[model samples]
Target: MDPRILDLFCFWLLLSSLLRLCSAISSASDHRYALGDLVPFYANKVGPFQNPSETYRYFDLPFCPPAHVTEKREDLGEILNGDRLVHAKYELNFRQDKPLQSLCKKTLSVEDVRIFRDAVRKDYYFQMYYDDLPVWGSVGEVVDSSGRVHDRRYFLYTCVHFEILYNEDRVIEIGVATNGETIDITEDKDVVVEFKYSVKWKETNKTFERRMDKYLQQSFLPQHVEIHWFSIMNSCVTVLLLTGFLTTILIRVLKNDFIKYSCDEEIADDFDESGWKYIHGDVFRFPPFKSLFCAVLGSGTQLFMLSIFIFMLAIIGVFYPYNRGALYSALVIIYVLTSGIAGYSAASFYKQMDGVYWVGNLILTGGLFCVPLFLTFCFLNTVAIGYKSTAALPFGTILMILLIWMLVTSPLLFLGGIAGRNSTADFQAPCRTNKFPREIPQLAWYRQTAPQMILAGFLPFSAIYIELYYIFASIWGHKVYTIYSILFIVFMILVISTAFVTIAFTYFQLSAEDHEWWWRSVLCGGSTGVFIFGYCFHYFFARSDMSGFMQTSFFFGYMTCVCYGFFLMLGTIGFKASLLFVRHMYQSIKCE
Candidate 1:
């Protein structure tokens, strides 16, 4: 191999090693612990079971506080994930079991009663951590078995059972059970709540490396593994059928058309012009809004690559659900690093199109996705602040993100734009454009761009909708999504289906003598996003139990951003595929 290639490979290996080292250090604890060594415990967040995003600090509900109240230092990803780990009041020792002991006894005031009552009514759950392993338990519950809103007794869970599993001296897992003492705080006068806890340590043969495997194996996932496999196989079958149909139809039709055109050129003095051949002169005409289109394509290209890299990393176990904020942190860092690709793609494409406004194109490319996302984030942050939820970003976090954009992302983007503008060649079209545009004939409503887009989008959407359900459940519900390999396969299928369907629709549009397939091709491919958004609506109302303004806004707002990204990525794929198909078709025939 060349020295340059060797150098690149070495660099990649170094980076991967560093990343793995960081991950291990972040997640794992020293296996050897001396007897009576203090094991630090941390209280994380509390939230309603139904609303995953709407979390608050663990102490928000007047929970017992630690003497010093120190917070655990967290990285950017952890903060973004809404983790707020504070020192817990419980005293734990390595390999030492504590019998049922009194943690804290407090007399509840009227205000405290109200808070506890609300939390119990909402079915709040709290999370804690010991040696990097997480434990979760419910706060309280309503005493009425029938679940009647009126005349119900509010019972607070005041005791905890901690089961710690150890492999030799290494702590492997921590389990929490809240089915302990319950005290009724039905009246506000004077209710003394005594909080208690017991610790039990047991030996296990499981290695420290496999400690997190338990959290990944949720009971719900085991039961649904067959369904997940079936869904993936169904999507694979869809792709194969779609691919076969498109290949067979396009091959037979194109062959006949190619033979007919070649024969006519050989014999006829003046061959009758019809179908796609009639508008060959104007087919390569530059579309309107060149700058915006180029910017979109550029951003789409960057997103496309970013997604692939993230998925590849996930498949290789760089991050998992147990690793709090690792995936999101990777996404943010990779996106920042890849900003240059967006600028370069846009600038190069714009240059090829003979566009003069280089600076404007760069600016547009940089802002195309960031601007909308920033605005949405601001709005959501405002809502989070209003609700005093942990989802709201801190001022410092926001500043850090801005600094990253201004200092790092912007400079890389400009550098890429400069490189692209200087290095790229002029756009080469297989056929020359005519000075006068060809007149397109009117067609039936079903053949129109909108109708074609709807039809074109359905196939790709159908391929992924089933997978989308599990994804939504994982994100919005308590389900763990550990099947990245299957997800990666489905993603590939979705891309293939989108490209093939978009190309077929483009062919149909061109056969109708419509040379304005530039934007139509993109729209046809991107229409899957609209379908995805529509599915979001169905999921929100019909499937999810999510309610309240905060949850509703969060669900729809973030989903819109997701669907828009899908639109851009798939749209770019479609346009590129159709472009290739058009060029090959025109180049193979005598279009002069």
Candidate 2:
């Protein structure tokens, strides 16, 4: 084995062990504190309750500040997730209960009142952490006593109550109660606002290892579980039916076609020159814009592998809701590492197609996905900056990502392209192509690419539509998605459905004497993304309470990129499956 390969394998092992150790340490009661030892309380972020993605710095609001504030160091993932933990003024001692204590008192000016009123009206909430356990509290609330929209009162919660549950010396859980003092912020006058907090330590039998169990079940309601199971069963049924139907039809059709065309050489000349056999020469012809198709397929392959690895990690409990920033961090790192796969796949396919511009193919492969992603990121980042939201990527973080791409991703991609160009075999079609191009007969309305693509995409889209709803809720709402096992199952069903549907469509197109199945198969398979994007619209309008320009733009903008990713991933799967189907069908028929 190459030393570099061995070193890479060792590094992977080390990384896996570190992740496992971190997960174990996070849940274990390894950190013990004596009585009177200071327990640092860190304020995280504040955001509108309706929009989880819209978050701002804890101190963004005109709140009382500490004498000298310090920030808790965070990893790349945490920063990317907009987690800015800062030292809070609330003082707490482990195992030491404190009576109601004044944190800070300040006279709220008109501007402060306006800020508080707006926050209260928007139902803004704040988050904090103690002993790595999270706690949430609302900034204020709007009470409509008169049952009229215009007759509303905005009240700010001035006092916060913290209850810390501990097992022995380790903190098991932290809860925040906001039913303390409240003051009306409806008035614009200067008001003396006093922030107070009380800490009470309670003993619990719950072990430290089970400390995160509550959070795991925080959003896993009975109804949600039922819905998830229902979706999975529904998807499985669809896949079984669709697969059985496609298998039976394709087998019967291909069997007859094979027997008819496989007549002994003496009788083969009498057969009619029609059906898919008529287009054998054109079926394997390189599609137009070969570089783009290859690049999309390559990127799709990379995304396909990336999704599988991430979901597998999730299924094995490497990623959980409590592990802040870990999932996104892993996604970034894994994607960067997998850039070489995209390069290899794209370059090899292009080379096999007798492409000469290997360098251009490599560049297209790298940029096909990243270019759109970068543009979307820039748009979203601009909106975040305009709204003063923490979702905006910091300049340093952006620079770091670019550096990773430049230093690691780009080189690996180039090396993979080189290896692929050197090692890949030439295109070997079972049937030789004629010098003149074959004219495709006029296709019927139903046989046209548009209708075929729509029909092809709907089955795969239906298979995962229910699950998409839950996923959207989990991502955009407060619901936590912990059912990775079911998600994985649905994902597999989706892939199978896409492949079968694409192959069936390709067969139909070929039978119609349209040998342009290359791009058609890819488009048909990826059309599921179009349906998904359409569903995003329905979700935005019918399902969610998300409004305003920022949230709306952010939702649709990111969703476009997500749907595009689905397009590439599923399209690649379809194209590969169709390619094999075409090769086997043509090869077995004893084409002339």
Candidate 3:
């Protein structure tokens, strides 16, 4: 092994660690509180009942079975509060056309109560309300005539009794309420009913409150939307820049060196027994090069694109914790859409390896598309049925996904197959075989086996593992999106670590005389996921913070993407590095 390469690697790790530490320190300087105080204090609010007409119903819910609700049947887990509601509850109706005071004579049914319950449960988190004002609540005991104590709902309220009823038997109803006000029914009819609850930002310590007019005016402007658009555009530009740089490097390196080396014939003289000749043809006869190429190239592109998408969305508030399923959806969609990139990468590598078999290439390309979809169904089918997780692909959507893969990706893969089969690739390995055989060096405890080398790659990577864990935790635990800096750090770590590990592994493989360069790339490159899985396992036991269901989903869903991305990145790094090493070895040793 070159001491220079190893020292350079050690220095790289140190520098990366220092940069990350500096970034963390800079972020901490902006903090407003002590370590314990950094956790956000949330202000609980009750009702806005903001706009009831546009509320989502069961039938329209994503991924839900088409069903109509009449008399609401409470599924124990599905409905939040069951026994608290008074059955056949009172309802009131008002017409925007008629003044609220004039149209107050409306009767109510079970349906109106159901609508109110669903709206409150689905949209808001407040547990207590009085005449529509949110209040802090306490549990108290009330004695029934039977002399048994029952739970009573106690909330601070100015109103004595609240009645709800429905009028005109409308399918949907909207209402509003103002601060502790009772309607004087029987005069005007145009006033829409509204309920208002004022909340303060828990983080803001001051008592100042914005005027209602100003708040309303500010909320209507979509300034945040424009910010999100700009963030995505910036991310796309970054990806293009990185891609162009990598492309230029790849092309230049390929042009400069072209030979691949397996074993030096001169080195054979150093062996104790000439019987070692049995290890010749089989020496460089590594696994199918196409598979390795496909995995790496596909993954590199996927990682690059995914990091851009995630960070961009993070910047835009789309990947924020509250956006349920957005992260998972992003991951699934990226992989599905990147099939073309994967097929093309795999095909190119296979061509470089001088491998043939168009039928095999076609089958392999199609399989990558099907595998993830199958796994997704295994994990999400139940959730899809339960929440109608509305995000899961509908039948039509799934069919469309398959059609795109078949029609669009499959053809490109076929073309790649033809190109790969017909293409002539030169092997530069015999040059290394003829060159003065340098003594094969021994690896330390770290770089010998596939597992050890993989773990070694995780050394620099785990320095930022804390931030990664926090990001994953926030996603699982439903935290807000305020921690954008941490996300960017995570993005940088994944990219840098992938590149470093690939370079390191290629160096190690070359040192160990395992010059079956292409397959070695996949092995060393794919090893990073093993370390990621280890970290995930540690998180599983260490963090007792997530719900069982969420924990399960996060673990599997996260593992799926991590493993997929790790292998993909490894393959890419491994292949390119291996190609470069082979070329370097060949150019150095080839006879004139």
Candidate 4:
């Protein structure tokens, strides 16, 4: 063969090897970014990297965008901006995510340049919250790439995942990068700005836009399917057990009692009159701490209704995850609006209990729940301020919240109180109370307050205990929980469990000839929150990897208030259920 032929053959072989190498490298890179490569905890969770440019008067701390972000990482598109921002810099809203990455390394005209510069001056080095973190992404200014200067700007933006090496001192190190460009485009000839990205995610199997579809698909991974069922089934079993026991009691006891008592022939040898019949007079007596009872009921009713509406809207797909701010706003507005219900429920009940001093009652009703919540929030916010965490609310935000509380809630509550006070409805107790209080008899160990409360609470907790795990993970760990439908079911089941369990306890207390069932009924259902708080303690001690005073204070403080609210709500439900039960029992028999 001639020299030319030999050279051509060598060139062909070399080109073939180069092509194969490039192909292999590309395939490996794709596999490297697969979901499997990431830690299971982080692979499923995504957070928005927020801008931390704001400097508040009191302290320098950023505020979290999605209030439910720490609770459940739902898609916020409906509440915030759901649409992905294109190569535009106009959107700098507090709720909207910081703009990132130029489409094809965009070149802005003179007008675009001025607008972008203004945006940058306002909020440059845009911040985002992602992977349960706040990351900084810088904005770059690039001149025209073409030789002809058209008064243009060029730039790039990116996200980055960082790691801290804590020795004697904490050393911040930037790790994996998020598609940031290496080329600097600030100079002449052609200017470009490259944004940096975080490499914190262990793996990202596919480029999100790798396959674009017209229909938007929310990220609802099926990994938690098994755990979800386990939770649901566990709750179902508890309900089944409760139903079985209650059914048997209803059949065996109520049938016999109703017949003998209604006929006014209690001397029947087979029918035992050892139960609620003994407490007819005392059953109608007003309970101790009636003021607190009314308050709890009022607030509980408000919370229950608020939860229902929010969950309903969420299930209907109104509060989409991308627009998470709407959910927070909804919660704030709803909570304020519900004050009327709380006030009416509290005041009317107080009046019915033969209580006067409507002013004191009204004040206590609102203050009881709100005071603790506000205090806890303040403490947590203070901690956040010290740590420079985004959870801190600035003074302005605090003022706005306080104003909303004072302006909207205060008036509603006052009107509700007046409405309740002036109402013609009187106390409708079925049985007349004795002039003197009746003494309660000795109770069995299992029928004691503590034992009954513990037993009653366990059943209700089972309904939500599994769901709690995912909730904690979403809030404390990097997990997203958008299963609103399942949450609704669990909530209903929990309410049922609490009601039934309290009723069961009331029956036993009545059987033991103890007439102090009012507080016990509340305690019986509210004890579930004690168990929830216990689990919170356990979560902090064992399950969670959270550290630092900011996180610690925020978790424990807010959760304590949550537990308190839960206690109020569940306890109220239990009391209502037991009241109905007691009334039904007495109504069935003709009073002698």
Best by lDDT: 2
lDDT of 1 by residue, 320-396 (tens): 55577777777887788788899999999899999999899999999999999999999999999999999998999
> Model 2, residue 477: displacement in angstroms?
0.7
Candidate 4 segments exceeding 4 Å error: 1-220, 263-273
lDDT of 3 by residue, 1-592 (tens): 8744553454354345333332312112332222222221121222212211111232231111213323323211112111111111112222112222321233323353333333333332222222211223211112235543333221111111222221222111112233243322222233233321222111222221211122222221244435434443454454455456555544654344222222355753464422112223333443454554454564465465666665665575454222223454444444444444555556665565565664665466556535674676556544534533322334654565465455544554555555644553644344324333333445566555656455544643454454545445543332234556545754554554555455555544554554454555665656666667677766656763333352356356646666666656655665565556445443443332
- How many pairs of residues collide in each model? 0, 0, 37, 46
Error of 1 at 121 (Å): 0.4
Reference-based TM-score, model 4: 0.68
lDDT of 1 at 261: 69
Instruction: Write down the lDDT that model 3 would get.
Output: 0.41
* Positional deviation of residue 199's Cα in model 3 after best superposition, in angstroms: 13
| Candidate closer to the true structure by lDDT (higher is better), 1 or 2 | 2
Give the C-alpha miss distance for residue 531 in model 1, angstroms.
Answer: 1.2
Candidate 2: worst-modelled 10 consecutive residues by lDDT:
21-30
Stretches > 4 Å off in candidate 1: 1-31, 145-147, 264-266, 269-271
Better of 3 and 4 by TM-score: 4
Tens-digit lDDT string for candidate 2 (1-592): 7755654664465356446534634434356888888876799999888887789999989887788879988777788888988999888789888888888899999999999899988889999988788889999888899999878999999888888888888888888899779999888899999999898999999997788788876666665788888888999899898888888866898898989888897787687779999988888889999999999988999999999989878887877665778777778877877888999999999998888998999999999989999999999999999999988988999997886677667877888888888989998899988777799998889998899889999999999999998889887888788888888999999999999999888888999999888999999999999999999999989999998788898889989999999999999999999999899899998777
Q: Clash number for model 4?
A: 46
